[model samples]
Target: MTKKHYPLFLLMMLIFGMMQVKAQTSLNDIKAILQSPYFEKLYSNTYYSLLDRMRKDGFLPESLTGAYEGMYCRTTGAMVSLLIETSRLKEAELNIKCVLDATTQNDMERIPHVIGIKDNKYTIISDEHQIDGQAHVLLAWARLALKRGHTNFEDKTWPLVSAIMKRTCDRTFFQHGWWSVEPGLVRNISFEHSREGRRWDVWDLLTQSFVGAALNDMATVAERRSETKLAADWRKKMEILQQGIRKNLTTVRNSDTTYLEMRLPDSNGGTPYLGMGWVTLSPVAAQWEGLNHQVMRNTVKAMQQGMLKKTNGLAWMPTDSYPDGTVSNEIIGKGQAWEMEFARTEKDYNRIKAILDLIKIVNAPKPVYMEGGWLDGNGHKQSEKISDTDLAAMNNAVWKTKDAGNGEQCAWWCWAMARLRVAAGLPAEPARVK
Candidate 1:
């Protein structure tokens, strides 16, 4: 921990100073954030929270006993990363195998979007298939399997991943592009944690980031297996994905800057919130790189102009921007946390410092109330109001923003475990970071 650490500083102290820290983060400073009181609390509390929920039946229910109780496919991979980073080898292997063992086959995809745990047995709970679920798992599997220098684990797991990630047996996507979820549609399709209606499918900055990371993971694993041809192919795909995103999905904001859109332009043409969000920041989780990633530097510049809010303490910027020309006010801690890691990836010390300040303000680990992020157009707090009311009974006066819809709790912020990994110099699992 840094000698400068204090457990009780007021959250507002750095509200102004954080912006001035444009300097790069030293490795020691990164270690300091990792060992800081906030990180320790975030790491241990969240890990235990998930550990307590790990059922002997080999499933980690979304909630111990609540309406939202079930398994989300994305959590497992991020959880596996947590265990691996912390040296919980057996436990990590158990979770990885648990998820693989329970994978149910669907014509649509092998990896189910949601699974329900009941009386020690888990079953598919939804028809939905999300690319993020498969991406997170593949990334985790690749990293852990590589660390052990063995292909047995991947050989065992590959059948399922291949099925889920497979675009065509002919491997047509190996050249052009790939989807995040399987039966991988290239048109409007429902995706993970999205309820605003089907957006463009096939690819998005959000899903492609993770999928590209997975491709790189597979590339590394293939290289390790001495499958040079396969590794080269995977590497090419990863590059294509990353470069494609850098090329097609960004807009020249002005002569001096450019920013990535939330997803490629949808026919719907909704929300200015599109360009500046987790959609841009979330890509920091991957090993994929471009000739230059100035897109993020510009993104941080654009976001700071408005997005990151200060109510209830300095919060990460809200999730979405609406068509009405207003950005969200409610803070989503998971998004904030992951964005902090994104800053860490870029060595943006000031952003990381601001986010750590927020964890202290909100008492993140203990109860994990993801501070509401939807803001009134006037910059007043509306996160709680918007979250409390989902689609059907929205408030006329309230800002329209949809949250993760866990009226109860989001499995004690299981995502925190992985964000901690990113803070510890491991890559973040984008989709699962939430």
Candidate 2:
């Protein structure tokens, strides 16, 4: 070969070798982050705290540090997801049973948002039925049952599962191919919009996406049990829901790119919401099956372009503001964790590393890992403390937001780290405690 061509060939080989090295380095970097002392301490502390809060009836408080006294079904479902991801199947099942027990206490077939304990008796705290909360709990149960791989597990849970499906599929809840937040229930419009003044009726993307996801998951379980007709029905419902989501809740921007709306206008005269926040990315973050891959990619791209910002030289996403000018933007820990999960799904190792670095930075100042709550854009914790009057006005029980670490935030961060390890070809286990 000529000397000139030989030099070019050698350069090409050098570039290829460097790429290989970078790939290997990326895997090692993820492993080091997972194995770091800070990660181990946070995971261990949070895991034990969750277990400690488990009652005889399997109730676990939403957060030990916050005014979170009752067992919030949505938060409990997320904890169950974390437990299942970390291979704690028995614990996950226990939590699912707790949710089922709470769900059946009413004749309306509606799952209460929060279940509290009074005088050693389980009591319904808030009857504000949330579609996504119900879906999350059901999905967690289905996932745990599937993971157990025992036919009897399915048989034991099928009755409760069927009841939930019956309620969730009821026309009052499932309207127009998408699940609607109950009318006049005064539910939070979205997780990010929880502080916004009361909304009696709303249709949120998180609810729609999660309901579709739950249906798909239940369909898988049904197919596993050879319930072909039921499985087909659920699948068909999911397909219709997906289509409705695309047709009604998506808007075309930049002439060709489609993005999902965070909330849709209700018959009660609510306006359509188009925002770049965590709620807007729920379809992808929830990993709903059969969604258009390009749509998810575009939605994430749009969100990053608009809502993604840096705090303390690390990346994070800010929650949206209320249209009525009640609550403004703030950095939320769980939202950032959700973004990290999406990054891990996309195999964006550099982005994952940046988020991990941010987590370390946020917790470095705290005595212990703090609950996933509000933070300023500058990375300082916001005062989550709620006054008694404010709690009463909101119709909530004592909700003293504590500065100390709690279970929900820890579970989210740990879940992300564990999933990242799995993405890097490691087992789905927490880091060894040092």
Candidate 3:
């Protein structure tokens, strides 16, 4: 068997082992996991750190010293919600103000620019032809508007979002069923696939994920405003996009086992990010097979065997691939791993617990306060603060990390996973109880 196939077998065995055992989580159990001092500290630190970064640097960057402002809002919004849910509403409100402040300072709209706040610190480098940033920008706006009940909500963001979505739909890149960044500008500039780069032509899932999230937010906002027609229209659009996602979904097969493929346009016909099998846990995914008993089991089993790091607790980023299927010389896949976890069923509690355990481990030694923490849009660390205390102690402190530019996009992934687990009938976490 090939090297990849070996892991699949082991994963299958792990799943089998689970089948003979009962899931050990109750609602209180899940809530306890969420409220655990370790997990909460990580959540609070990372959420605010990004805000502090934005205030200090004036623009969120994609990394510690990198410049890419287009994608920070979504992460920012995601973290905002996390702050609110965790009873840190005041901090969340402050971060929202910072982003809005930055937007005004930058003269940015829904198609948020990628440069810095003053004197063009760096030219924004993107294909200059796609909508992940645009979608994320809208997602952030809608999230803030909805959560805060901002009086100027429509007057403030609707126009920008409307124009951007209209432009996005008009793009040939998106119109073409595959949904890609425009070709011929710069390979890997955005998540577009083209022959220009010698790199493997892998489709980026974040684009779709962001778009899906934005649509959901838009629909939610429309519904709240009692704009039934608008809500219905947006919901239909989301459904269409989601349906397309399902129709195109495919899995990678190695020998007798299969792993979910992270990117598409499967340029090499090989599963590069085998670790992405968890993404399928997206409850709202168009092609979700989560309702089926066996399929759910398969996913739970996959988590047990394939992605769970035996020693670290942190989940792997897609298989071994970097951004795309490109053979990176650098081991970019390594890190403390953030708070995101996949949830296909309540039965998958063990997997969730494992993720929480890892969060404890990663945050234990260097936990910071719940203040503005920063990680890029994808939730990897930037130059965020790190202290000497263990994760438990850090839970009570406020972080002051520079904004990595991604505000809450990182938090949204974890938030969605948590909600999904609850939706799957997982019990409430114990700690959330009054």
State which candidate has the highest lDDT. Answer: 2
Query: How many steric overlaps are in each model, in order?
Result: 12, 2, 35
Once model 2 is optimally superposed onto the true structure by TM-score, how far is the C-alpha of residue 67 displaced, in angstroms? 1.8
Q: What residue runs in model 2 are displaced by over 4 Å at the alpha carbon?
A: 1-25, 105-108, 151-153, 177-200, 266-271, 321-329, 367-369, 373-406, 425-427, 431-434
Worst 10 residues of 2 by lDDT: 391-400
TM-score of each: 0.70, 0.79, 0.56
Ranking by lDDT: 2, 1, 3
**Candidate 3 C-alpha lDDT tens digits along 1-434:** 89989999999999988976555664557667666666555545544454456543334444433433443444454555455444444555554444455555545543443434446433333324345555655665566667667456466656556556555544333433333332111112254221222243343444555565666777787777776786676566566555544433334333323324344343432233444422344333311231233443454455444433222223422222223322211111111122233343344555556555543443354443211222222222333222212222333332123323233333553444445445544431213211
Per-candidate local distance difference test: 0.54, 0.63, 0.43
**Predicted structure with the largest TM-score when compared to the true one:** 2
Query: Where does candidate 3 have its weakest 10-residue lDDT segment?
Result: 327-336
After superposition, candidate 1 runs with Cα above 4 Å error: 1-43, 64-67, 104-109, 118-120, 168-188, 193-202, 256-259, 264-273, 287-291, 312-316, 364-434
